[model samples]
Target: MELIGQGMEGAVYDLGDGRVRKIWFDRRPDDVRPLKAFLDELPPLPFRTPRIHEITADADGQAVSEEDLLTGTALQESGVAEEQALDAFVAVVEALRATVAGPASKALPVLNQPFWREDLSWGEALAALVRRRAAESRHHFRRDVPDFDNLLETLTTRLATIEPDRLSVVHGDICQPNLLMDGPRTAAVLDWGFYSTAGDNTFDAALAAGFFDMYGPDAQRLDNLLLDRFERLGHDRQRMYLYRAAYAITTATIYDADAGDGHYVWCVGNLNRLPR
Candidate 1:
């Protein structure tokens, strides 16, 4: 097997059997149960999700899975036309929405793990993250306000009051790189490691909006496309936009903490778009 990609939580390997092995980092016995539960519940959802062939738990309780690797190129590397990318993104989102309505969908827990149910609304979740960041910053650097303080405060104030009644199972992380496109449509949604059941569909849309803002020249086009789809689905455009801004900030903060300057650059791009 050859290592193809790696991240904070897991590593992907080209397993030579026309498949990929995604092995999670060493985990405690307690963590295995939820992961196993997630893997077991993945196949029944009604969307373009990867099919897991097998799941194996090592003696030390770490989990690994071999699954059908998406044969098509990732959207980031596809060199697809902007209009086509937008269409594919919309199709995938619709498919995911349908999946959330399926009876088996609720088996998988919300993406943020143990604290999932507590923050059922997107705004609540963002507020919790902002509060956690503030506390962490205070503990690490006393007195003065941190760079993220203002951004977090503004986002929390704006989003905290917005009601999040639109619920769906979201792909938690919906960036371009994780989406695979074949021909002109999304073939499969790879990487279910961050899948969740509690977030609103807007959470996924926000992720898509943030990605287009980061990579595409016609950033507003992607935003419009997503909002149009949400409207067709009967979602409020204003709320979706709010979640998009919040999601962008939340995403950038995670990357900035884990990775470094590259993520900071991404953070600034998203931060600049927050509604003044």
Candidate 2:
């Protein structure tokens, strides 16, 4: 076996049998159910995603799986044009929609989790992250903490008045690196670890925007285009934009701190650029 990739929870290896193995370590308990659900649901989709052959859990409860995925370059490395990239992105969204809309999309009785929809209030969601970050900060004793409380207060106050009646299943982390492309037009999304059953799709869109802004030039244009697309889908563009900005800030703060930087410079940088 040879190491192919690694992340916070697990490492993936090529097993030299047209298959790959993913072994989990130090993963959250909350992750097990969703990952199992995702794996069970994935093979039925009429798209090009990895096929899980088997699931093996050790006595310690780590996950190991043999799977097959198309071997190719990452989409970001391909440098596809914006239009093509957008089309691919749309395709991914549509595919996910179909999968979740299928009969099998019903919430698992064991998990008792509903499909991601408009049920979660923006304030509630933002507050959860803030609380988590606060706890994390105290545990780590890191200095230069970002003003998470103030940021959360502002976001909560703003979102309290807006009622969200629309919702959808979200690919919680839709950054470019998770996307694989065979060419400019066809692509596949990998890494379902962060997939959520209750999240604003706008949050996902904003995350994509943040990914672009972090890596490319004229990223604001791309962000605007994404927001425009959401608006056309009948979403509240302004509110979603604000929520997205808040989500970005919160994410930066949380991840930066977890990675040992108490001050979330990246998130603050994006937050400062939010339209007044």
Q: What is the C-alpha lDDT of each candidate?
A: 0.61, 0.57
Clashing pairs in 2: 116-197
The reply for model 2, stretches above 4 Å from the true place, is 28-33, 42-46, 50-53, 58-61, 94-127, 134-150, 158-167, 258-263
- TM-score for each predicted model, relative to the true structure: 0.74, 0.73
TM-score of 1: 0.74
Scored against the true structure, residue 84 in model 1 reaches a CA lDDT of 86
For model 2, residues 1-276, the per-residue Cα lDDT tens digits are 999998876898998988888787864344455555555665344346655677778678777777885565676787798788766655565455443322222242111223223454644545445444445443332333345456555766675555444444556666667778777755456766443443455556556655644545676677677667656765566676676655554455344646445335555555556555
lDDT of 1 by residue, 1-276 (tens): 999888877788998888988787964444545544555565454335666676777666687877776677788789898778777776666666654332233444433433344434555655665555445333222222235566566767876676655556577666677777776767667666454544567667656655654645666676667677667777666666666655444444354454345554555555565555
Tell me how far candidate 1 lies from the true structure as C-alpha RMSD in angstroms.
Answer: 4.4
CA RMSD, predictions in order: 4.4, 5.0
